[model samples]
Target: MTQADDLADEERRLRQLRLVVDITAQILAEDRHLTLCEALRLIEAARTTAGRLFPGRQDTFDLVVRPRLERIVLERFGIVSTAPVN
Candidate 1:
């Protein structure tokens, strides 16, 4: 693939990741019926989807994306802590 093609593909993957994260956040925030276990499962599913989309970028997802979802989960559930959640 040419450089432009590679750039386009990366951009597409980025958009997919963003969509996944946004949807997960929306669910975690708005779904009052969601339990803690369900929220954790959603986060895990998002991580798996992100891994499939970005291959070897798990660390990037954990560092950048996971925290955002975690924060929403914490706020929605009315919990606060510095300890690792998962």
Candidate 2:
């Protein structure tokens, strides 16, 4: 991919992460804490395209949504990126 393509891809990833941050924040706003089951439930409740197809499968939640939510939570609390710099 060209430099522009890379930049665009990064931008898209950041946007998606931001959306995850926002939605996860809203869903977890009530107690500011959640049990593992609670977190899974929240992800299952999402109305995204994948959610509609896959429903509440724990495997889907773990493989996809959970990591994004974890990253956003970490990012919000001033933990520097664990992702290695390119």
Candidate 3:
């Protein structure tokens, strides 16, 4: 890829990462009843579902957002995963 292509890819990934963080934050904020751990789990579940159903940049925001936030708890929050990362 050309330098411009590489930069574009980086920018796209960064944008998606921001969207993922934003969605996770919103999820954490809106559901006050759930504990932090529970909310994190919810995000995980959403990620899994998105991976299976959407897989990647399909079109809709739901498809794009979910996988970007995927597995963030394990990577970001250091959650002990019962299963290995695939």
Number of the top TM-score candidate? 1
Residue 68: error of model 2 in Å?
A: 12
Which candidate gets the maximum lDDT versus the true structure? Answer: 1
Locate the minimum summed-lDDT window of 10 residues in model 2.
Answer: 46-55
Give the true-structure RMSD of model 2: 9.8
Show model 1 residue runs off by greater than 4 Å.
84-86
What are the per-residue Cα lDDT tens digits for candidate 2 across 1-86? 99999888768755665576467656654445566567556555553534434355556656766666656545444457767755
Off by over 4 Å in 3: 42-86
**Stretch of 10 with least lDDT, candidate 1:** 77-86
Query: 12-66 in candidate 1: lDDT tens per residue?
Result: 9989989999999999999989999999999999999999988988999899988
Candidate 3 lDDT over 46-73, as tens digits, reads 5654444445643444555544454454
* TM-score to true structure, per model: 0.90, 0.40, 0.44
Ranking by TM-score: 1, 3, 2
Clashes of each: 0, 0, 0
